[model samples]
Target: MDFLTITLPISGVAINPLLLVLLGVAVGVLGGFFGMGGAWMVTPALNIFGFPMPFAVGTDLCHMAGKSIISTRRHAKFGNVDVKLGLIMLSFDVVGIEIGARAVMLLERFGLAGLVIRWVYVVFLALIGSLIFYDFIKKRQMDKSGGDQSKSAITWHETLHKIKIPPMVNLPMAGVQCSLWLPATVGFMVGLLAGFLGIGGGLLMMPALVYLIGCPTYVAVGTDLFTIMLAGFYGAFTYGMKGRIELLAVVIMLAGAAPGAMIGTIATKYIRGYGIRLMFGATVVCAMVSVILKQMGQGGAASWVIMTAVTLMTAIVAIGMFKGAARELRERRLSHEPR
Candidate 1:
């Protein structure tokens, strides 16, 4: 065990590199499938493993930027990305990230960074998780009653689209027409969270694109990954300049994340729509419970809960990909047979 431990040169903390690789692989799959950077899971996991909040955030952002680039490219090939919409959101996202980074730095100075960040994670995760589950349940009820199946239970995007503000823009890929400010506003808010939480903004941005910006589920996933890549680059740079990042950890994580990301992005082609939403909601709920446990001084339980959730989700996504691939091969073989 002692031979497995290595001290991070910058952070001066000894940790098992294998653990970092494992976290990377799990998050890479979840992030690619869910259209997030998986910072929500990694930051907490790193903190539980003994890294300070700031270092955990910085290293996570650095690792996320690289993984997101891979996921975004894969999504683009599937015609899932809306480039125009992603670029528009990027403009405002960077500014919000800067503000958030500053806020975290201030909290660190006061020795309240860890406490404040953990509490915020609990609150934010609760809201997002609840909304996703509620929407999933409502959609199931609609299916049973033979109501319109196309409409989601939460229609905030519809109302927002109807606002008719000036400078309306059309996103053909996303099949959306709305005020230009709509996505920019959403970007700023999500970016704020990214900076403060060390996330790539994908956690919030994916749902925001679907529920607040009117993008289709697949398009939202791709576009969110695009935005996450750019935001992650800026975040990594910001944290790096502040001497918060551990390059050794980032490199180790990327080793596992690369292959895991490919599996996740492909799984989306099979899972589709509400399936993604359901898994995402479950992931959030698990993360929230783990954070709550950590706050209650159950550190070992918190670690187990989060790691178990990540491993399970990764397996689910990988299984879906394999099954979908096999089915496709069978259909292709049948098509080739002389009729």
Candidate 2:
């Protein structure tokens, strides 16, 4: 056990390298499947495991930039990415990141970084998780009642699409026709959270793209990952300049994350629509519970809870991918039979 421990040069923390790799793998899977950088889990997990909050934020961002490149590429092959929409969001996202980074710095100056950020995570995760479940339940009721099954129970995006402000954009890829300001506004807010929470904004951005921008679930997943890549890179640079990034940890994590990301992205091809939303809701709730445990002075329990949550979610995604791939193969075989 002691033999596996390595000291991080920058952070001066001696931790098992295996933990870093495990976190990377989990992030990779969840990021690809959920279209996030998995920072919401990683930051708290890292902090729970020993890193300072600032270092956790910086290292997570650095690793996210690399992992997202892999996920984004895979999603594009499936025609899930809305390049125009992602590009539009990137500009505002960067500005929001800068503002968020500054806010983090200010909080650090007052020695309230960890406390404030953890509480924020609890609140944000609760809101997002609740909304997802509520939507899922509502949709299920509609299905039972023989109502319109194609529409989401929550129709916020419908209202947003009607804004029709000047300089509208038509995104054929995402099947969205709305004002450019819509994504810009969403991007800025997501970026702000990304910077403040070190989450790369995927947690909120994915839902926003689906619920507010009216992109299909898969398109939202891909586009959110695209924004995450840009946000992660900018966030890493900003945190690196501040001397908060742990390069050694980032490299170690990426070793596991790269492959895990591919698995998660491929899984998305099999698990569509509400399936992703339901699992994502569960993941968020698990993460929120872990954060709450940490805030309750139960660091060891928090670490176990978060790690277990990631492992379970990763297993579910991997299993879905295997089953889907097998089904496709069987279908192909049947279709090509001597008929």
The TM-score that candidate 1 achieves is 0.87
lDDT for each of the candidates? 0.89, 0.89
Can you give the TM-score per candidate against the true fold? 0.87, 0.88
Q: Provide the lowest-lDDT 10-residue window in model 1.
A: 194-203
Q: Which ten residues in a row have the lowest lDDT in candidate 2?
A: 194-203
lDDT of 2: 0.89
Segments in model 2 whose C-alpha atoms lie over 4 Å from true places:
1-17, 47-55, 99-120, 196-198, 242-248
Per-residue lDDT of 1-339 in model 2, one digit per residue for the tens? 999999999999899999988888888988999998887688878897799999988988889998999999999999999999999988888789789989999999999999999999899999999999999999999999999978888999899889989899999989988899999999888889877986567778888888888899999999889878887898899899999999999999999998899889999888869999999999889888988997899977977887788889999998998899999999999999998
